[model samples]
Target: MAQSMSSPPPALAARGSQGIILKETSGSRLESTISGSECRVMEFSSDGCQLAWCDGKSVTVMDVPSGAVKYTISKPKTRCIQFSPLGSYLALWEPYAVTKDVPAGTPNLHVYNSSGELVTEYIQKKQQGWCPQWTEDEQVCARNVTNEVHCFSGGAPGLTCDNKLQIAGLTTYALSRGKLPYKIVVYVPGSKGAPCFVRMFAYPNLNASAIMASRSFYKSDTVSFSWNKKGSAVLVTTTTEVDKTGASYYGEQGLHYVSARGESNMVQLSKKGPIYDVDWNPNSEEFCVVYGFMPAKATIFNCKCDPVYDFGTGHRNMAKYNPHGNILCLAGFGNLRGNIDLWDRESLKPIKKLEASDSTQFEWCPDGVHFVTATTAPRLRVGNGYKVWHFCGTLVQCEDTPPKQELWEVKWRPFPAGTFPTPSTSSTAPPTTIEQPVQQEKKAAYRPPALRGKPYTYKLHEEEPPQRVGAAEEKEKDKLSKSAQKNKKKRESKLKSKEQEQVVITRGSKRGAEKDDALALAAQILRGNKDKVVDPVGSGKSDSEKKLKNLRKKLTQIEQLKQQQAEGKQLETNQIEKIKTEQSILEEIEKLTLS
Candidate 1:
């Protein structure tokens, strides 16, 4: 079927034995007809404005809606016609060899511009080979019997077929449809008949350096190979045949995964049934495979080759991933009824199913959300065309071709539109810098001598030291020197007095009498009677006993002063001086008593 953009209502052209029927896509009404017989192939331009068809030896290019022939090329033995992706050119080729009487090296392939002018012709080295194919990027390619692919650069006036590369034992090949441009995957039989391998080759050059070969397997005859939308992996289905004695078995089947770099996990389908079809999801990393015959099953597998979903118990005929790759369409003939099941790839569940007595082929729209199912008429009857439907099972429209005509094929015209969202660009913010205050070394704060033994406490606000002027600095230095000298003197005098008091206490007996004598000296110093104080002894007189009592009272007062100093309390300078004087007097009294 050919869909034309030039047609205001989105026209679809279906070929039948009578001719070609042009109908509106939104309705079943016919718009125009191009009368022809045995139309073998039809294709629409990239823009969907022009339609082209080949009837064996002749090809016709037409304005789809007007049903008027733009140009007719009478090329004998023309097998197929294809429009370039850019809609600027068409490729026509003959798959079979030329007749013996034809000129010695006649060209079997011809290239024509949109204006129907001959652009180039490809002369074959051999009499027969595959037809020429156009790559997604518009390069013309053909493979010869020698397993060598020849690429021709499409340009004005002609195509250059000078570039050629050999792929030994090439069985089949598929071009990647993903971001990796022009990556060609070719299957080649293994050396020594061990197994077959799938290898990827770079386009154009087809260099040995870029070739990645997959693992070898016994089933070298590949049924089909499909590439994921991301071009990360390829799904391959192969069949193996075994001969025992005089009997031949052909049931060994397998499904394998090959990475873009040609790595294989060597996973095989569990069932012994032959794999009929395999399709990769365009939007995800999963694929669906159809196998078995009696009660066929469609199984979906992730990239890891793990089964994720199963459509149980049906005679599966065909399964395909929608262009968006989010939906899987499964169709098969069962119980005399054709079943078309639409499945959501993400959910792994069925979204819709339509049953028709003769439905067979399922073709998805380029929009991805819609698809069409082609059904044949029952025994040369009418009503044999295609049913247009949304993924949700809603019938959009249906058009039946002329009666008693077989619908050869149905396909949506390829358009330059995307069903998936474009990747968003990352908007990263620039790094930021923070300013910090300049750090300065701080001097240890000054602490009073009385509080030096305790833990240092931090001050919320410390007063800055006064800055000294030129003359005032000298005066300040002198004052500090004098104060330091005075403090040293006081410290020395206090140490000496403590030593003398310790000596007096050591000389006396370890008794209350020594304590009393020191107390008496301290009291005399405190009362300003430094010379009257005397050391008490066992004189056996009442006056001596009274002196002892006075010494005890003064000793208690001296102990209280020491306690105050230990508590971090400051003692008056006079009191400190008085204590030092008492210590001196006590030492002298001890000597006099001893003598």
Candidate 2:
């Protein structure tokens, strides 16, 4: 259900080095604040009803609506927490530790109900891939075990392990979101010259015979999967450790598509480079990929793997579709200068350009009209803060970490689907009482004292500025049919060629127009064949030589076209017309040779 009057307003939570703050997103009003200990991590329940966080001592779950503490579980050393889809249970992961008393490391992964009672526990050693995967309905949960996946059916308390997917050398698995009959995809890396493979299996029947779709690839050392919102299909991105072709240093990557109905195929990327990011549209029928080298390209593809629209090329490494799938945020962060471009999905036109240099994370608010970009600790240890901006590129709120303190994380509280309606887009930013920060003017690059006065060229590697391709050219692009567009291009090319020829004709000591006239006259005389050649007394020898040279060049081009035609080469309309003029050109050349 959408947000009711009694429901909590959408909130923004930030965890700094020493404290955590939860504030209402609408007015930036502080709702809750917990301090005095290092805030480790924070998570909102899948339904956004409860907010949970760990502070090195205990895991606290807060009822978001009432701003009251719901549960305070005494699970110290917790590194991560995740709430199941329906928010009925929360899973926590603590680093595994070996002690003299319990050397095997008592279950570090624990699941607890809303009442703070431990429901289940498992021994998950490594922090990576340690979280228990849950289906959207929360009726099933699974986790990776030694070379296999153990799945449990029913709710948290007294959950029964009724299914186990035993794949030799299983590395990882992903559970799809949404209604019943959920699908799961598992990956197993290649070994001994064997190809790596992924297999999709529906819930309840994960056996080999129950596999619905499968894909195998050779160049992958590891792979990641992106399932559309509907969970009917998935995009698999495979990566290799090294590029054997030596074309790139970042390694080779490939994208493949697999659906729930036994459809599997490789997604052919047009450019050659690492696949930076792939995101499926909320509609689940289309997806976008940002890929290729240096000036990477972003393109939207339909479910059939056909390119729907190209966002041209820019310095982008990430593509994010808002919850409504109407706006897409393309950004380049880490190594590249942080530049964000927002595009309208319908018109395929850019709507805004934003920059948050040094940002390490970006996410859209469930409302879809607001977004948050943050620069936290460890990634850069500097510029640790978060900025909330209206999707129109207005900086609505900017909070920087205090000196000596660092921001650990920032997240918008999640809400159920349709809880926040999509706001109509407007170029004008809504008025906010919070004062926006004044962006600092860019400083000039430093030059050496010795070369200060010397004329040296310095080039700054800057991201390509946004160019409004659709808006500027959409009229001509949409008004013309495909063939009309092609003919238009041809006409433009011919006009350009004519202008270039005119430039050459007007250049040099001899006027090219006169030579053209001589050629025309020679062709006319050749057509008559009996017309006597009139070499005027003052007819410049240079002019005749230039005309003869032009006629001979035309004859040579015609001969080449005729030879190509004889060789069974298909000639264009203009090429065939040029071939028809071969005899006339030969007659003209004969007249010039005889003269």
Scored by lDDT, the top model is: 2
RMSD of 1: 31.4
Model 1 lDDT per residue over 541-565, tens place: 3653565454446555666777788
The C-alpha lDDT values of all candidates are: 0.63, 0.81
User: Pairs clashing in candidate 2?
Assistant: none
Question: Candidate 2 overall Cα lDDT vs. reference?
Answer: 0.81
- The numbered model that scores best in TM-score is 2
lDDT (10s digit) by residue, model 2, range 361-394 = 8988887778899998788787788888888877
